[model samples]
Target chain A: MSDQQQYLIIASHLREAIQSGELQPGDKLPSEARLSQQFMSSRGTVRHALEKLRAEGLISSHQGRRSQVLLPALTQDFDSVVSFSQRCQEAGKTPGERIHSREMIDAGPRLAVQLQCSSSASVLALVRVRLMDNTPTMVERIYFPEEIASHLSDYQSSSGSMYQHLVERGVEISHAHSTVTATAADADEAQALGVAPNSPLFVVNQCVYTADGQPVWCSEQHYLPELASFSINNVKERPSPSFFTPGRA
Target chain B: MSDQQQYLIIASHLREAIQSGELQPGDKLPSEARLSQQFMSSRGTVRHALEKLRAEGLISSHQGRRSQVLLPALTQDFDSVVSFSQRCQEAGKTPGERIHSREMIDAGPRLAVQLQCSSSASVLALVRVRLMDNTPTMVERIYFPEEIASHLSDYQSSSGSMYQHLVERGVEISHAHSTVTATAADADEAQALGVAPNSPLFVVNQCVYTADGQPVWCSEQHYLPELASFSINNVKERPSPSFFTPGRA
Candidate 1:
């Protein structure tokens, strides 16, 4: 087999070992040298395999030692475009949502800029509380531009994935930009999420764009910090003298 | 000049206007068509210029209307590799630090894995609170491997930037991995940041690496959410069957 395929095969074997309890949580993986010997793959390939598992949070790698199998972890990776419900399913959890309210409203000045639509435009607004394993976890206040909102009338259930539903209806999602911050839960948010007032919530301001660069929707989601967090891996680039605002990001 | 150059020049002019108070906050920018006509550029180019300003938080853009200049904002962009102190100076804010303590400690099993070092290896530990404008904003618990830690002794001051100090000392810094989560402030963190215990804080778990993939240091930073937050721009890629944990990022 080719090097790429060999590495994937090795990763698959390890994944199966973890899933089947062959290598239980807290078990140290075989040393890289032994894995390289057994698979007849170069150490680079072996390391590549390990990195993939690390990205999945299935294996924890510390330098100069064997990696350890981790307990099933629920960590969000902003790098992927997977829908929220699908992700919960992947982690063996049931996902549900309650539509607290929905309405067609005129885009106010603030929402107009956020959705990149004309001021006074008609927009669809949705307020939803998403639950994982029946526990409230996130409160999403989402707005959809008129054109995109029209497609959702038929597939508007919260148990399924809105991202997938839109995709099925031919919404070619191109990208998303998100700003993550923290906020103290207000009375309404606190009640909805079963948290005390002034408890911390992760505020994610996000905009979704179509493939042609049209803004499709915008969402302000408040997430419970206790359950989920964002994992980002950044590589240094050539110095660009770009001055950023203080530790905001 | 090329189209790229044209856009940048336009951005610079707009930037100058804002800084010079020619375009005051709450004032509307000229329409894209007018800007294009004035600059002898395409509407696309003018929009690109506007996008640049939006990224800097200097302007807010809504479709079918003029953009508005914005008040100065303090936000962080994780995409840049600039040092914290430098960023503060760029924003015209004073950055300071108070080093609580420093010591050499053995890398226990937990820390060893975190620093990616051999267990029982000598490690350096530093605890400090980073300040902006005389207000304590973040508490950083930092750990460095022996090699990198040794270089830190000479330049260990709270007033200067450790990132710059390391670079000046010939450390070829690479990229970083960060997991942004939320936590309720403990007594110690609350006392350090002058906030009530159980107030929400942003927990940034980060590890910096070298060019050759060596781990340089690991830090657990607690940020007062009122002062700073992370802004991220994500572009969607080809659909991968990858599953992520729920809304972590």
Candidate 2:
């Protein structure tokens, strides 16, 4: 094969390795000399394959260090309220959930306000550790009104998606307004996720509402920044640059 | 005032404190007993107020631990292709850049393919240390067609926005597609960003395209996850529980 076609083949094979998670994120690939030997190509040809992977966001390399394999594509529909399970499956991975705690509790001040009721109301607090490929990915805490999740206490939430369970019970969760923030994981969370305390985590706070606009659930999802990513699609222009005012162009 | 009104007032105050960064992310709030004593209210009322802030993604609490302030919002527009400087300005802050290195280099095989050009084509490589609020935020490495950024060699890029420069030059940057991943910082990057080596950083590899679909630039932006966030809207349609198809309802 010609040099160009040979490099393309090498690049394609490497890209598949990355997408398949066979070469996990942060796992370094062989050096140029090694890749050249392994692929039976010249040093120049091996470098070309690496460069293409880097350009496509599939790998990252440094001047003196070896290139590291990246995670599967984190890009997803940002405007659609998709579940963690759905996202993982879309990426061809098995998404699992481990119930950390599930119990009915007194509605606290925030849950009460979001549920549009008094603090004395009963609520179901569901806490779970979500996983992808057995790697702890997120710690989610969800609160639903007892009137809504009344049967949650007895539900088997281990094998399937919680939203699916809710939908089956007639909870029409249509959309959510979410706020995302960055924070240093505290000792507890970092320990739980097997990372150092103070490691960064993306915290997503979401308030789900029904089609009729009634708030149903207030949930907090904290993701290990390395395991997942969120995406958004925009057809119209982005919010005008900050310099443009209402009266100005 | 009624009990709910009093709690709401306290919640609002706490929310403002968190938003202003006076109570920073991970800072512990006053104990429930202390808050009630300080505010001259019942413990139930203080608890109620704290709960409201928690529900709004402003704070978090453990069963036995004091509630910690949630991280401040660090959001990126998912739809529009805007520069980091523009985003900072939108948040009402000055964005700054320190050019670390700039040089003209030969485009390699992979880049040549991505740019749809010859491998020996000349390119301008730009690396800048981006800062916000007097702290290092991100390291952006941009590669451009030499002809496009030729004048930038003499340009004092300090505190300047590249997007603004491109616009001034009549370049219409319509959109970009980016792949996001999470990885540990290396020795050089860790030292530059003042974070520990191997600390987690959000790596965004982006290929920016013009209105006519030409690749204008390719960049790799590494952000200190603790210092920034990328936010996107997700939709909810209750996809089926099948592990193979995540988005199909």
lDDT of each structure? 0.71, 0.62
Candidate number with greatest DockQ: 1
User: For all candidates listed, what's the TM-score of chain B alone?
Assistant: 0.66, 0.62
TM-score between predicted and true chain B, model 1: 0.66
Top-TM-score candidate index: 1
Off by more than 4 A, model 1: A1-82, A158-160, A238-244, A247-249, B1-82, B238-244, B247-249
Off by over 4 Å in 2: A1-80, A105-122, A133-135, A181-203, A233-249, B1-81, B106-121, B187-194, B224-227, B234-249
Model 1 residue B228 CA deviation (Å) reads: 2.3
Candidate 2 structure lDDT: 0.62
Q: In model 1, state the lDDT of residue A225.
A: 84
lDDT of 2 at B182: 58
Score residue B179 of candidate 1 by CA lDDT. 71
